[model samples]
Target: MIPPALRIRGAVLVGPQEVRDELWVVDGRISFTAPTGTAARDVRTVSGWALPGLVDAHCHVGLDAGGAVDRPTAEEQITTDRAAGALLLRDAGSPADTRWVDDRDDLPRLVRAGRHIARPRRYLRNYAAEVEPDDLVAEVVTQAGRGDGWVKLVGDWIDRGVGDLAPCWPADAAKAAIDAAHAAGARVTAHCFAEDSLADLVEAGIDCIEHATGLTEDTIPLFAERGVAIVPTLVNIATFEGIARGAEEKFPAYARHMRALHARRYDTVRAAHDAGIPLYVGTDAGGSLPHGLVAAEVAELRRAGLPAQAALSAATWSARAWLGHPALTEGAPADLVVYPADPRADVGVLAAPDLIVLRGRPVAP
Candidate 1:
């Protein structure tokens, strides 16, 4: 059933600084002006502070710690995120085919990266397309074509033979693979956790980095200059200590490195933000972490020293723009969340949305 037209009252945040007193949702699109002939009684009135639906910049719907899940699990994952007000998700990498989701209006929109490209045995088992450096370019092209304008790479991981974290691909191979992805019209992002992989990947023209815990003074400037973005996934990084403890007996050096990274995780994120490198919020959910933690990820960004508004933007306005999606604009889909108070005042309000409008329908909180 088509929902009745909605009259949104109070302040609507069209962007960080842009706000309007009222907005209308007609048929499923936003309209600044009221409908021509609809009677006042026909439009449902919702009063609150409204903002664009949240975006989870990095999430995997059809995946879990063990790998691809069934369709029922994937549906559950999308439902969890929708309840959190994350109406758009960038599936950074997932082994399962979740294309069926795009057909469901009730589900959050997804931007999928076909799968993670990793060196054989270097990343988590069953989570990526394992390929050697000799096959890197070919795999990148394949994933790029399979993905929705983006590709994921496992740039660094523990080298059991070396007893520490190391770059998975040589600099030359990294450059060639990135070039191939670009040639295929896809932007490339890599999962990076240590310093060694930072420079080579950034220099290779990769579009973004996930879990960029290794950013430092030298590399910070390069990332800022190149306009390369990072999704720190600080919520996921919180588990580094536990992971280190689990692997300590087998890889002592790696454990120490993980501890060091965890110790300075906040400082690393703060430094990147200060250097003007673009930072987006990502919970790294669907891999050990539960879904619907977009609010938690935003709070984690605040804890990392980003100002309240900046932190909010990482998941809302700026994030939508970065992903080329619309937010509270005329003719755009009516996907928004309303709060009893201004979220700009305290993003914690995100955890308790008064109303969540997906497309044109009001979702129960």
Candidate 2:
């Protein structure tokens, strides 16, 4: 493929506020970036500093069929043709990225851990097909082996005003899944919101915790010692009051669950940051959050006392690294965006991307 237009000169958010003097893309890799006089073919100046395309580590837009969630057999039955199979079906629960990338051409890329795995008749009760741990690992391994950035473990129903939630997968089960993923070179990301469930997941040796909740003074150091990462997804909880109030009409349990979700002391997140725990930003969109609105999560991290640049890196550079792409500089897949303001000073600029480059092609706005 022919190299798209090469971007040059502006404030590139590579690692915090470190802006290289210039940048350019060849075919699909960020070809050359250096001080003012960098050398490369097809030289044309791109107006703004280039940011590697945003990598939303926790998004779920794998396929279109997985949209209709929590519907009855009739609704879900017909919906099957739309989203029944396991291999695809993105689930409406994650509608945000469609707006973020497919609809607006905003970010470079967003990877997903697919639907959350839970026991039958639980929260993801409708769309998320629940299975025993033995079955779940096979499914998870199948997906993880596909070279996905990582694998997500989804239980710990306690976060919700949730059910006995079916006994969480036995520790042996969780570990088996974790081992399968690790053996395949993928880290496990769990969706936990309670201390007990978290302790179970921690025992499983997961690499990260998605939406970690009810963390105590003690839990922080354990994670630090193990070097696990935390993707608090704080904004989903912050705005949950509104989501619950709106959904109370249909999904009462959902409304109540959201309320409780918003109450916990993000102190866990704060402590994680204070203790130097790695953090990630995920919108948890679809069922709870609106799709394509990851910027709000970044803003929440900043509000939670994380530096603006740190929040930006969590979504950009750090996120990609967590997803297995350590070298986000030139020569990597060209996924980037150009915005009107300095992300370090004003994150609001993320809302309006002036230009977006994905895999080397700049989609004309």
Candidate 3:
């Protein structure tokens, strides 16, 4: 049954600077004023510093290290994120068809990117639709139709011949595939961890980049000029040291490159941000990493030199707008997290949301 209206007092942070003393959630939507017909007794009260539901801008919902998991496992992943107050997830890519999640209101809302499209034998096994350049455009078109207005590509991977990370798609192929995706009304993003792929992907009209550890001074301006956004997924990048170590013996060049990227990840991210390149928080969870690290990701962004408010916005208000979701605006769905203290003062408060409201229902406290 639908819950009665909730009268939320204290600081209602609707935007970065926009705040109201109080607000109400009626009929599953945010309302600035109390409903005229509702009696005082019908209103439940909650008070704190409220922010819109967190957004995991580049996460994988139904995927794991090996590939797609069953429905139960997927449900567990979603619950983990929801408990962390990540109400909006941009599923960067997933092999599984998690469309069933939309029917489950208890789960966080998802913006799927269909599945990862990669060159044969280039990406993790079973995690992508491995194809040749000849088929890149067709594959992109297919994924675009299946996804919720987004398509993910494995723009770079380790080349066994070179024993180092290299661009996966040629410039022409990338341009064709990205154009095809745009034609189908979807934005294209790529998984890139090395510098080789940045220029091609950005030049091809890509919308975003995941794990953009490759962003360098030379390419930062291009991304800023094109208005391409990036989700650093710094939490996942933190694992690069281990990844490099694992490949040290077999692929020394790749290992060294990974180490270099890890060593300067912060500087790279900060440089991109300073150059006006958009940044967002993404844990890169569900593939080797555990779920529920949105707060940690936000903290990592701060460590990368984003100011407190900008870092918080990477996962809150600005992130929501980037993903095309509403924040605490009137008539929008009531998905928000409340903390005892203002998150802008210390983003660590996001790690322990005092209250979590989803679709106007007080789901967690």
Candidate 4:
């Protein structure tokens, strides 16, 4: 039974624009977004912010489950993280590598990008889900064919022992991967940390660039022309460097590179915004940071010169749009999130939601 829908009246923050009114969630989809000029019965009052739940476009909850793939297994950590992450999820990452979450989930929804398609020996092999040559095309096709928004390509991998950058996919291979995903009606998101193999990804018509660390000036305009989004994950990189520097008692040159890239991420994102090129928010959390802390990305985006509203939009409405859900019409599962302050004014307002509605039901989990 679709219980009597609730209405949150106050700062009706919907996709960056704040409306001083009340919003009704009838049977899940937004029933009415009207001014709260008068009070009515059965109206649940929330004196704060209300907007679409955030879509963390990129994250690696499973990858952070530190430990070797030994016989002991990391099933618990993987399952727990994914389940917990779902409570406020719009998380995009590979679910194949991590122990598959087999929980009675009613929280965050998973729109996986699946296993990263890369060469056998690559820079991210330690992190990637590992797609073998024989199953590479099929795997890419599988995720894309299922209408799972995007296909993730591991174009860069961190080498074992040496800790150097390794090119994962050649231009031809990347082109093939993109073509396969395109054929399946999916966009390809390339993980690029250096300029060495970036040209191939751009030339192959990949949809988005993740961790725009090594993007040259020549590349910035091409992304604009092709209408591909650039998702700069700077914060997580910085966070990782700090942790490594603290944990290892050494600040390697890699830390400097990540720091430089983080700065470049800000500059390029601003450049993209000014040039009318799309920039999405992504925090590659597995390598360093924690999951469910995606709001940092919004804050970073704002710091990068985007208006608070636009940054909020990139997290909410834009993210929903990215997932192909243009409208939250009736009969749609109730997926509502309530905040207590203007998220645009301070992206940190999202840290603690007053209420979260998932699948037409209130949280009892």
Candidate 5:
């Protein structure tokens, strides 16, 4: 149940420079002013430095390395993310139907990208709707209709024949599929880890790219010019070395390619940011990696050259705005996180939030 009207006192860091002594939550929505007819004794009080709930823009909830998981596992993943103060989750894509989460008030709010559409045998087994170029447009429309305003595509993957990363969809097919998604009222994003696919996807009007490790001087401008966003998922990219080593025996060329990409990942992200490409925090959790690493991902962003405040914004105000969610605004859902110190000075404080309030209820401490 919604807790009694809450009075959040102390430093409420609504923005980089905006601060307030206190704020109130009445009936699960934020109220800049106190509510009427509420006794002082009846309102609950919390104190700390508060920030809008963090966002994970490219996470996967009902998915694991093997594929779609059971409901209980999905619930566990959701709880883990909620505990980490990730109150808004943009589920990048998943094979399972997670519509049941909408009814859960205590769970983190989700914006799903129905499922990953990839070329046959190009993606993780059982994790995508694999189809040929002829079927691309139809699948894009189908997933766009199924998702919450977004659809995902696997733009590139390792081509076993060539033993190297290659673009999955031809330019014509990509353009047709993207147009179809747009017509269906959904924005499209893609999983791209190679340079060859960047131009085509950007030219085709894709809204965003996930694990954009291949971004370089040539393509960064195209992405920025097109107003497309990128989620670096630095935390996930850190595993590239291990992935390369695992494939070294069978695919030496692919191994070298992965290592090269991993070595220059920081430079790629830094260049993208320097070129005005929109960067957001995405831990890429729920595959082989565990959930609740939003803090780590923000730290990684900082390490990749974003200032402390900018890095924090990747998971906070900026991210929420991009995802079409409100942040610490009047009449918005009262989802926020409290930390012991100023996060702008050092983002590491996000690792241990002092309190987490979701939908007006204090859910963590």
Candidate 6:
């Protein structure tokens, strides 16, 4: 059955600030004008605060902690995210192919980064296209073709030989691979958790960094000058202490480093923001962390010293624009969420969405 035409009233559009009284959803598209002939009963009116649908910049759909999962499990993950009002998802990396989700109108819109490209045995098993430095360029080209418009790389990981976090790719290899991905019309982001790999990746013209816990005064300016964005994934960073405890006995140096990074997590983010480095909210969900924590990530950004509006925008307007997704714009897909109160006033209101509309149809929140 077709969904009723929606009349969203008494809500504020987070950005643009063009229409305050109402906006209409017709045939799964946003329209500012009233429908000419629709009967009153055929129209559904929803009232509350409205904003562009939430965006999860770093999430995995078809993978779990153990690695690639079956379709049913992936669908469940998507459902959990949808329930939490995340109508758009950027799949950071996934070993399993989830292209089938594109055909399902009920599923959240997804932009995938193919599978992660990592060095042999350097990344978690079964989660990356492990290739040696010599093959980095070729693998990036291949994954760039496989992905929507972005590619993921494991920039650094624990080097057991060194007993601490270390750069995964040599500078020359990273530069060449990133160039290859760009030639294929794809932007590249990397999973970076240490200070050493960041300068190399940024100097190579990387587009974004994930879990950038190792940022410092020296590297912050580099990232800012290059305009490289970072998704702090503070929600996932909350797990660092537990991980350090688990590795303390075996890798004391790595453990201590992780704890130190955790200790200054908020300060690191604040400094990055002050340096004008672009920040986006990402939960790093579908790894060890659970899905549907976009709200939590926004709250964490606030804790990191971003203003309330800036933190909310990290997950909403600003994030959508960064990913080239339109937000609450005319003729765009009608994907949005309604809140009981102003989320900018207190981001905690995000945890409880009054209604969620995906493709102009109201879905249960």
- What 10-residue stretch in candidate 5 is worst by lDDT? 35-44
Give one digit per residue, the lDDT tens place, for model 5 in 194-256.
899999899989999999998988999999999899999999999999999999999999999
Per-residue lDDT for 1-365 in model 2, tens only? 33435765676666774677667676566755432332344455666655666645554453223444332322322222112101111122231223323333223333445445665544453445467667977866765744344666565663233432223678888888888888877767777766666666777888888777656777888888788888787866676677567778766765665566567546567778888888887756554444465677777887777888788877777777766663348577666777767777887777667776655666543
Q: Please give the lDDT score for candidate 4.
A: 0.62
List ranges where model 1 is wrong by over 4 Å: 39-41
280-355 in candidate 3: lDDT tens per residue?
Answer: 9899999999899999998998898888888988898899999899999989999999889988889899999888
User: lDDT of all the models against the reference?
Assistant: 0.93, 0.60, 0.91, 0.62, 0.92, 0.91
Model 4 per-residue lDDT tens digits across residues 26-144: 54556565324332334555556666655667765455544124312334323332332223332345443432432444435656675555666663345555665456677788767
Residue pairs of candidate 5 with colliding backbone atoms:
none
Candidate 5's displacement at residue 241, Å, is 0.3
Cα deviation of 93, candidate 3, in Å: 0.8
Candidate 2 C-alpha error for residue 11, in Å: 2.3
What is candidate 2's TM-score against the reference? 0.76
Worst 10 residues of 2 by lDDT: 81-90
Model 6 weakest 10-residue run by lDDT: 11-20
Q: Runs in model 4 with CA error above 4 Å?
A: 17-20, 33-43, 67-92, 95-105, 124-126, 129-136, 142-147, 158-166, 240-256, 327-333
Clash list (residue pairs), candidate 3: none
Model 3 TM-score, all chains together: 0.98
lDDT of candidate model 3 versus the reference? 0.91
* Alpha-carbon runs more than 4 Å astray in model 3: none
Question: What C-alpha lDDT does candidate 1 achieve relative to the native structure?
Answer: 0.93
Residue 234 local lDDT, model 1 = 94
lDDT of 5: 0.92
| lDDT of residue 168 for candidate 5 | 100
Measured against the true structure, the TM-scores of the candidates, in listed sequence, are: 0.98, 0.76, 0.98, 0.79, 0.97, 0.97
